[model samples]
Target chain A: MSADVLSAYPASQLAIREVGLRDGLQMTARWPSTPKKLEWVDREAAAGVRYFEVGSFLPADKVPRFADVREVIAGVSRHPGAHGIALALNQRGATDALATGVQEITLVISASEAHNAANVRRTQEQSLAEIANVVRLRDEAGSATIINAGIAMAFGCSLSGAVPEDAVLRMIDRCLEAGVDMVGVADTVGYAGPRQVASLCRRIADRLGPLPYVLHLHDTRGTGIANAAAALDAGCRILDASLAGLGGCPFAPGATGNVVIEDLVFLAETMGFSTGIDLGKLVALRDIPAGEMPGEALFGALAKAGPPRAMSWQAARP
Target chain B: MSADVLSAYPASQLAIREVGLRDGLQMTARWPSTPKKLEWVDREAAAGVRYFEVGSFLPADKVPRFADVREVIAGVSRHPGAHGIALALNQRGATDALATGVQEITLVISASEAHNAANVRRTQEQSLAEIANVVRLRDEAGSATIINAGIAMAFGCSLSGAVPEDAVLRMIDRCLEAGVDMVGVADTVGYAGPRQVASLCRRIADRLGPLPYVLHLHDTRGTGIANAAAALDAGCRILDASLAGLGGCPFAPGATGNVVIEDLVFLAETMGFSTGIDLGKLVALRDIPAGEMPGEALFGALAKAGPPRAMSWQAARP
Candidate 1:
C-alpha cells in the first residue's frame, strides 16, 4: 500500500528553476554579500538545484544589490552541473550579461502596456525592439547562452487591468521571431487563477509545439502553487520559484514573492514529479537568508510544518 | 474581451461552505459570544454564503466553546436561505443536534485507525456502529436532517501515516450503507497534494456516481487552495473552508486551520465558478474574527492583497 498517488503526466520531465538568489534578493532591504550569494548557489546546487537565476544585469547604481552579478555568475559557472541565468531588461544589460558568458539571460516585456511602461518606463513596442536587439547582440557574439524572454503580467496586470490573451500570444510570437531560445509566461502580479494559467499554458503549448516555456508565478494572492500545478497539468515542465518565497514586483503594488521553491518541490514530488532536488537540504538553505536579511519576511509552509509523516519520495517517484 | 477565463465544468453548481465557527474556533484560545457568532452568520449570509457549519454538538463541559451550539443553530435557521450544519461525534450529540431541528448534522469517522482511537477513543468499527445508531435514531424521530459522514484523514494521517485508498473507500461504503445522505473527505493533517486529492476524489466519484461529496481541506502545508482547485477539476462541487483560515487538529500536531474561505471564494470566483459569494463583503468578514480573537493568528492572501483591480463579478460569471 504505497502512500503516494502518482501524477498522470511525466514526472521525470518536471524542472524547478531557482530564482531566489536574483529575484528573491531584488526586493530585499539588504542583500547577502557576494560570498554569501555564492554559498547560497553552491548549497542549493549541492542539493540538486541545477538552474539558478543568479542576478540581474541592471546598472550597479540603479540596483546596487546586483552589483556583483558577474562575480555571482562566475561562481555559479564553477559548478559544471548548474546553469546560471541572469535577467537583462535592456540591450546594455544583455550585452553586459553576454560579456560575463552567463549560461542564460532572460529579458522581460510586459503584456499590459501600462505595466510595461510603469516597470521599465518603455512601451511594449520598445521592449520588443530591445528584445530583438539583444538577440542580434547574442548572435553576433556567437554566445551559446540561452536567450529567454518573459512576458510579465501575462495573466492580468495590476496597473492595466485585463491583459488580453491575444496581446500575450502576439508578444510570444514576436519574441520567438526575435530568435529567443525560450519564453516564459509570468503572472507578475499574482493575479492568475489555476484555470487562467492552464488555459494560457495550453494555448502556448498548442502554439509552440516543442518550444520550451517557463511559468513564472507570484504567490501574492495565494494562487501561486495552484497555478503551478495547473501549469504542470497543461504540460508545463519548467517553473520559476524563489527560495522561501522571497521577491516581489516593484510595479505590482502589494505583491509578494515568487512561489516558494521548497514548497513547490514538495508539491512536485508529492504530485509524482521528480524535481531531483532534496527537500530537507533545500529547506535548510532558508537559514542563510534569514541570518543575513534579518526582519525580512520569510514565507513557506513546509518550513513551519515538516513534510507529511507518510511522505516517501521513493513511493512518489515514477 | 472578457478578462475572466471560465472553468470547463459547471460554474453555477459550485458551493463554498463556511466552517469557521465550528472547525475554526475548535482550537482557538478564545471564541466570540453567541451573539457575535450569530452576527457573523448573518453578515456572511448577507454576502450570499448559504451554507455554514455552525458548531459541534458535543458536551459543553468538555468543549466549552460550543456550549451555545443550539443558540447558534437557531440563529442560523432564522435566515431563510441559510442552512446550518453541526458536527455530531456520537449518538448523544446527533440526537441533540436533531432535536434542535438543524438542517444538517455531520458524523466523522477517521480512515486512519490510530487517528480514530486518538481523537475519539474509539475504534473505526465503533465509530461506524455509532453512525448506524445515529441514523436509526434520526429515522425514529422522523427528522429531515441530512446526515453527512466525513472520512477524516482520507488523504493521509499524522498518527497512522498513510491512509490507504482502499480503507477510505471501504469506510465510505460502510457510511453510505449506514444511511448517510452525503459524505465528506477531510485532509485532517494537510497531508495531501493536488494530485492525491484529484486521484482520491476521482475514485470516490467513480464509485458513487452523482453522489454529492465535500472536500474539507487544511492549509497546513500551503497546498490547501491547490488541492481545492484540483477537487473542483475532479468534479467536486461543495468545499469546506474556514474564515481567515482559522482552526487546527488537536490530534494532528502542527496542523494549521482549514483553507481560507475568502481565498477559496476568490479562487472559485476567479476560476469562473459562480459561488454567488460577494468577494468584497466576504473579505471584510475577516475583521470580525481578527477583532474578537485579538492575538490569534488569521490567514489569507486576498485579505492582504486586494482583489485584482480588474476582478469583475459580471465578467467572471458565466
Candidate 2:
C-alpha cells in the first residue's frame, strides 16, 4: 500500500455511494414507485447521504423499476450537495441519461466474458467498445457528467471462475484509455475474501497511481464488510453499498446481498473515519423498504444491535 | 500491527478449536445423542480438526446436552492426535473434568460484573477466586490438562455494555496471576468490530509476550469473520468457532450465532494460512445439525456457494 495514496484521502473521511435505488430495486419483484423513490432520495439526502445511485438507464420493458429514471434524476436535482449517479451501458442509455441532466454516469463492463454475455448479451470486447461510444457521446454532448467505468466480476465470476488479475488490469487500462474519469472494481457475484480483496486493491492502487478506484462488494459469502475493511487498509477509499443490504444477483438467486450501507457507516465511524451519515437516521430509513416490500430479507448487524454506546457519532466525528 | 509476531506464526499453520458440542448444543433444544456427538468428534478428527471443545462440566439438569461429557472425553481419547477440551467454571467442575481425563479445561469469567452475575450467579471476584481454587485442585491432583482462562465479554457485554479496555486487561492480569497456562478473549455477546478486535488482540499480545492468546468470536453483528481476519492480522492465532454457525446468546435472544468454523476455515485458507480442517467434511457435518433440529437456522456461505474453484485445499496446502 502506498502511503502517498492513503495520505491523499481526507484523514478522517470516507465516501459511501448508496446503490440501493439502482442495484437493489432491479432485483426486486415489487419495487418502490417513482414517487416513493423520489421520497427515498429526499429522505436519504436529508439524512446526510451525499452520493446516490438514483437509477439505471435501461429498457423500461425489461426493468420496470427504473422506468422513471428521469423523474428520479429531476427529484435529486432539488438537493444542492447530493450527487446523483445513474448507470448506462451504451450510447443510447448515455444519451438518454444526459438529457436528464444527471451529474455522473457509470458505464459497466464485466471482466468475465461469460458474465458480460449473460448480463448484457455482449462479449467483454463488445461491451468495452460500447462504453467507449458512450464516453464519446458524453464528451460530444458537452455534458459535465463524469463517466466512472465499473468493472463487474473484477474478482471472480459465478459462470467463469478465477478471473485472472491480469485480465482486470487490462480492463482498467482499456477503461482509462477510453476516457473514463474513474474506475471501480466489483465482486458481481461476491466471490472474494479479505486477503484477495486487499491484494487486488493494493495492486490496482499501485497501478492506477492517483486515479480514484472504488470497491463495489457484495456480502454473498458474508465477507463483504471484512473485504471493505481490507480494501480501506490497502488505500482504496471509495465504496458502493445499498440500504438494508437490499440487492441480490438476478442470475444467482440465493447469493447474499450487497454490503449494507448502514453497517458500513457504522464500521467507518467505529474505525474513527468520518462519514457524514447520521447512523440513527440512516438506520431508521430501512423501515421504508421493509414496509413497502413485506417479506423481503433485510440484513445488517448494527440495526439489530445498536452501535456501541461508548462512541457517540456526533462527538466522535465532530 | 507487529510484523514480527505475525511472521513468527508457523507460516502454514492456524489452529481452530471447534466449540460446537459445548456452545452449539447448549443453545439447541433438541441436540444430538451421546453417540452422535462422539461420531461428530471422530469424523471431525478424521477430517483433520485437531482440537475439539467436546463439552462443559455443567450440571446435567441445567444443560442436558452435555450430560455425557465424561463419555465424550473417553471417546475423544481414542483418537491419537485429536486433543479434547472441556469448560469448567469452578473447582468441582475442574475436579470432575480432570477425573474424566480430558486433555484441557477452560475456566471462564466475564469481564463485566453484571454479565458474570447473570451468567453464573457469581461476581468477577468470586469467579476469579473459584478459578484460583481450580488451578490449585489441578496441581494438587497431579493433572496434566492444560488450563485456559477464557474471559467472556472481554470486548463488551449485553448485560453491561461498554466493558472498559482497562477492565479487560485487569481481568487478564488476574487470570494470569491465578496460574492459567493460556488466556482467551471472547466477544460473548458479539458486540465487537474489526478495529476493536484488532486493537484488543494487539494489546493482549503485547502484554502477554510469549503467552498464547485465543479469540472466541460470535457472529451476532456479522463481523465475526472480519474480526477473525483482523485478529489474524494482529498476530493472534487460536480461534474458537462452532460448526454451521450454530449457538445463540441465551441472554440476548434473537442475536446472531457463533462464527461458523467452515467459513473461518475458508477465511484462513484463503489468506494462505493452513488449518488442516477439510472444508467438504466440515460442510457435510452441517447436515447432522440441520437434520436433528429440522427448523434450525444453519448459516455459512461456503456450504451454499462452495469454495472458490481456483484454490484446492489439497494442492494449496500440500
Candidate 3:
C-alpha cells in the first residue's frame, strides 16, 4: 500500500531524535557514567538512530550529570552519520557546546512566562535576547551547528496554566527572526490532548509554510504519543523521544516521563511513516538506564508486550 | 467551540461504556465483593456514566467474580438513565443474562479462529451459531434488550496472527445477518495501531452505512487511548473503557489493561466531544478499584498528573 494512502501528513519519512541522555538524565537523581552514556549512544546508533541530544551545556553545579557533555559528543562523533546535539541556555552554554563540535544546539524558552521564569530564572525577553546572541556567536565562530529553538510549554504550562496559541506563535516568530535553523514546539508539562496538539501545530505549520517543526512531548497526562500522532497529522516531522520513556518535567507535579522512544517508533512505523529505528534494539537498551538507576522506574509497553504478532518480529531486529 | 469543528466524525454526543466491572474483573484475580461492585456501579452512574458492562455470564468456576451478576444488575437498575450491559458466551450464558433483565447483552466471538477456540473452546462457526441461537431466544422471549455482537481480535490476534480485513468484514456480515442490533470491534490483543483502527473501522462503517460500532481497546502496548481517538475519528461513538485502566486479556500474554476511562473522557471532552461523564467523579472512583485490588496495578495518566490546567478543574465535578 502507498504510504500517503493512510497518512494525514505530507512527509514520507519521519525523524525521531533521541533525548534520553540529555532530557532523561536531567530528571533522574542518578547519572550514567560517561562511558555508559557513550555505550548507550553507540548501541542506539547501531539500531539506526542517527540523531541524539547527547547532553546539555549547563553549569556542572546545576546539572552535574551532563558535565561530560564534551566526552559524550566526542563518543557519538565516532559513528558515521550520527549527529550529536546539545542543549544551551545562554551564550556561554552555546559557546561551550560549539567548542565540542556538536552538530546541533537546542536553545529553550518557555512560551508561558511563569514556566520560563521558573525553569530558567529569566524573563522570556531575556531568553530571546540570549538566543539571538547565541545565533550571532555561532555565525561569528563559523560553526555549522544547527540551532533548534525549543518553545517549551507551547501547548500549556504547569506554573502559568493555559498558554495561548497566539503567544506560542509569537515565540516561534521571535525565534525564527533570530535566525535559528529550526524550531521545536514542546509540551513541557504534558497538558496537551490530540486536538489541542493538532490544532496548534497545524496553525504553526501554516504560519511557517515549509519550515519544519519538531514535536517534543511528555506523557505527563498520558497523551504523549497520541499528541505526536496528531502533530504528524498537523505536518510535524521531527519528534523528540527518550528511551524507555525516561525524563519528567520538574515543574509539573506528578509528571512521569517523556514519550517512550520505542513506542513512538512503533506508532510512526505502524502508521506507515518509516522511522528507521529498530524497536528491538531501542527497547533492549531500557536495561542500560535501569541498571544505572537500580531502583528507578522505567516505562515502555513494547518492552513488556513484545511486537505485534502480525509483523515479522524477528525481522525487525538487527 | 462546536463539536464538529474539530471532530473528524459526525457525532456531537459521545457514548462512554464503562466495562471495568466486567471486562476489568475477568482477567483480575481479586474480585470486588458484589456489594463493592454495586457501589462501583452506583458511583459511576452518579458521575453521569450512563452505560456499564456489569458482568459476564460465564460459569461460576470459570469466572467466580461475576457469580453475582444478577445482584449487580439489580443494583444498577435503580439509577434512571443507567443502562446495564452484560457479556454472554453462548445460549446458556445469554439466557442467564436475559433473566437478570440487562438492557444489553453482548455476545463475543473472536474474528480469529485460534483466539475464538482458545477463548470459548469453540470454533468460529460454532460461536456464530450460538450467537444466532441467543438472538432467537431473545426474540422468542420478547426481551427488549439490544444484542451487540463483539467481534474480538478483529484488529489482529496474538494466537492466530494477522486477521485479514475480509475475514473481519465477513464476520460482521454474519453477525448482522444474525439479527443482532449492533456490533462492536474489539482489539482483544492490543495489537492495533491508529491507522489500522481508523482504516478498518471506516471500511466497516462505510459498508454498514450507519451501523454504530463500539471500540473495545486494550493498553497492552500502550496505544489504547490513541486507538480510541482513531476510532472516534472513524465515527465510532461507543467506547469501552475501564475505570483506572483496569483489566487485561487473560489469553494475551503480558497484556496490561484496557483504555483508561478517566483518560478517555479527558481526551474526548478535550477534543470537543461531550461524553457527559464527570471526570472528577470517575477519577475519584479509581480509589475503589485500587482499594479492592491491593498491590494490583491501576493505570491512568490523569489520575497521577491531575487535570489539565486549561480546563476548569473545579467545574468538572458533579
Candidate 4:
C-alpha cells in the first residue's frame, strides 16, 4: 500500500501560532483587559506555543478590542523561545508593528476585489500597493523581520460568495513581486472542506515554491481541523489558531474567526507530529482570559479536555 | 492517484441519525418538556436529518430527560423517511420502545468492563444477556424493529482510559451472537483521532462483514470530523450528529457531546459526495426549537458559513 500524500506531512514538529489574542479578540464585542490578554499569551507560551501574532496596528477606534495590543505584544515578546508577531493591513500598520521590535510582521490582503473593498475599504490593487510600501518600510528600517503576506479569504468570501483561484494567484503574484519573505493562506470564514483546501493549497504551494505559508482557519463551520489537515498535506509550514476558538467577523454574520490553537496542537501532536506547545499550560490558559473578558466566547477542545494521553496510550499500544 | 477507501462509503443516501437527543440529552440537565424535545426532532428532521433518535425508554426517574420519550418518538415517526430511533438501555426499555412502534431500537452496551459497571452498574455479560433477551422480545413482538448493538465509549473509556481492541471485538462477538442486525461504535469521551479511528474501524468492519457501522463522535479532543472522514474511508455508512454542536457530557469534562449535524452534512456534501441533504435548510432547524430549550447549545457549520460555490478558482481543466 502506498503511504499516501497526507501520511507524509513532516511527521509533526509542526509549528502552530496562536493569532487569536490579536486577530480574534480585536474583532469581538468585548475586549480582555491588557493584563488578561497578556496572561493569555503568557499561558500559551508557557504551554509551548512558540509563535504569536500579538496584535495589529489599526486605529484604536476601528478595533478598540485591540487597544492594548501593543502592551500584550511587549509582555509576551519577553518570554524566551516565544516569538511575537503582529498584523499589518497597510504600510502604517507594518511600520508600527516593526517598531515594536517584533521579529515577525504579517501583512494581510484579500483575493476578492469586492471583499478587499469591504474588508479594509480598499481595492485589491490598493492592498497590493500597501504590501509594497510595507515591505519597503521594513527594509529601510533595517529590520530583517520575516514579512509574511497573508492572503485572507483565500478560499471563499462572504460578501462576494466564492473567490476564484486566479484571484488568489494574482494576490500571490503581487506579494511575491513586493518581495515578501513568506506567504500565508486562510479560510477566513471557515468555508473550506478537506479536499477543497488541499486542492487550492496545492495550487498555491505550486506557485510559491519553497516559501513557508501559514494556514489560518476558523471553526465557524467546523471544518477547521479538516482544512488544517489538507494544508499540512499541501506542505504549509505554520498554522494560526486561537487559545479557545475565539474571534469572529461581525460583518460576516455567522463566521467564527480562527481555529482553536490548543485543539490543533493536540491534533498534530497525537497524530505522531510534534508541536512544541505544552498541553497542560495551554488548557490552563483558558481561565486567565475567560475571567477578565467575561462574555467573550472561548472555544477549544483541549482547554476543556486535558492533554491527550499520548505517552501512556502509546506505551499501551500493542 | 488511486482512489482512497472513502470511495466505498454510500455517497448518495448518507442518512445520519442524531442519537444524541436520546443518548446524549439523556444525561444532561433536568428533563425538558415533551413539546420541547419534539421540537428538536422536528427541526432536525426538517433540516434534512432523515433519522433522529428522539428518546429512550429507560425508567423515568433514572433518566428524566427522556421521560416523555414516547411522545417524541410518536411525533417524529410521522416524518417521511425519518427513521425515529430510540435507545433501549435494558430489556424493559426495549419492550417500551417496541410498544411505541419505533422502526429502529438501539440496544447500547459499554465495551469496557469498568465503563459498563460505571454506566449501568452491570457486568458485560449481564449487558449482553439483556441484549439477547431484547432481540428475542423484538422477534416475538412481530415488529420489524432492528437492533443496533451500539457500543458507547468504544474508543477510550474515562474509567478504563484506553479501551482495548480485544474488548471491542468481544462485545461485537456478543452482539452478533445475540442476533443484532447491525453494530455501531461510539467515541463517548472524545478520545479517538482519525488515524486511530480508521485503524480500529477497519478491524471492526472486518468482523461485522457488510453490516454498516455508524461512527458516533464527540468533539471532546477535537478529532470529530477527522474521525468521521476516517470512518468514511473505512466504509462506514451512518453518522451520528447533534443539531448544533450542542450538549457535551458533564462527566467527560471536555467532551462536546456529538458532531454537529449541519457541519457533518456540510463536510460530506462539499467533498463531492452526495449526502441527499439540502445544506441551506439544515441551518433553519435551529430556529423552530429555539425558545423551547433556551440554554441548550447547538453546533453546526453551514449555519455559520453558507454553502460552497459550485464553481472554484483552481484553474483546473474542465
RMSD per model, one decimal: 6.2, 4.8, 5.7, 5.8
State which candidate, 2 or 4, has the greater lDDT: 2
Give a tens-digit lDDT track for model 1, residues B193-237.
898888888999999886668889988888999999999999888
- Clash totals in order: 0, 0, 0, 10
Clashing residue pairs, candidate 1?
none
Question: Which candidate's lDDT is highest?
Answer: 1
Each model's lDDT comes to: 0.83, 0.80, 0.81, 0.72
Which pairs, if any, clash in model 2?
Answer: none
The CAPRI-style docking tier of model 4 reads acceptable
Q: Per-residue lDDT tens digits of candidate 3, residues A1-318?
A: 011111222255577889999988786879788889989999999998888988889888977898899999999899987888899988899999988878888999998888889889999889989988888888888877888899998877766677778888888999888888778899887778887888888888889786677889998877887888888767788788999878976766445678989888888876767677878888888878988887666776777787775564212211
| Interface RMSD for all numbered candidates | 3.9, 5.0, 6.3, 3.7
lDDT of 2 at A182: 75
Q: Which stretches of candidate 2 lie over 4 Å from their true place?
A: A1-12, A309-318, B1-12, B164-166, B312-318
Pairs of colliding residues, candidate 3: none
Q: Score candidate 1 by TM-score against the native.
A: 0.93
TM-score of chain B in each prediction: 0.93, 0.92, 0.92, 0.88
lDDT over C-alpha atoms for residue A189 of model 2: 73
Native-to-model Cα distance after best TM-score fit, residue A16 in candidate 3, in Å = 0.8
lDDT tens digits, residues B1-318, model 2? 111222223334577988998888777768888878888888888878877888899888987788899989888889886778899877778989988868788998998898889888998889989887887887887877778889998877766667767778889999988887778899987777788888888888889986667789988767788889999999887889988888876655655678889888888876768787788888888767887777777877667656665564213211
Name the regions of candidate 1 deviating beyond 4 angstroms: A1-12, A249-255, A313-318, B1-12, B249-255, B313-318
Question: For every model shown, what is its TM-score relative to the native structure?
Answer: 0.93, 0.90, 0.93, 0.87
lDDT of 2 by residue, A238-270 (tens): 899999888976555665688989888877765
Candidate 3 Cα deviation (angstroms), residue A227:
0.8
**Lowest lDDT 10-mer window, candidate 2 chain B?**
B1-10
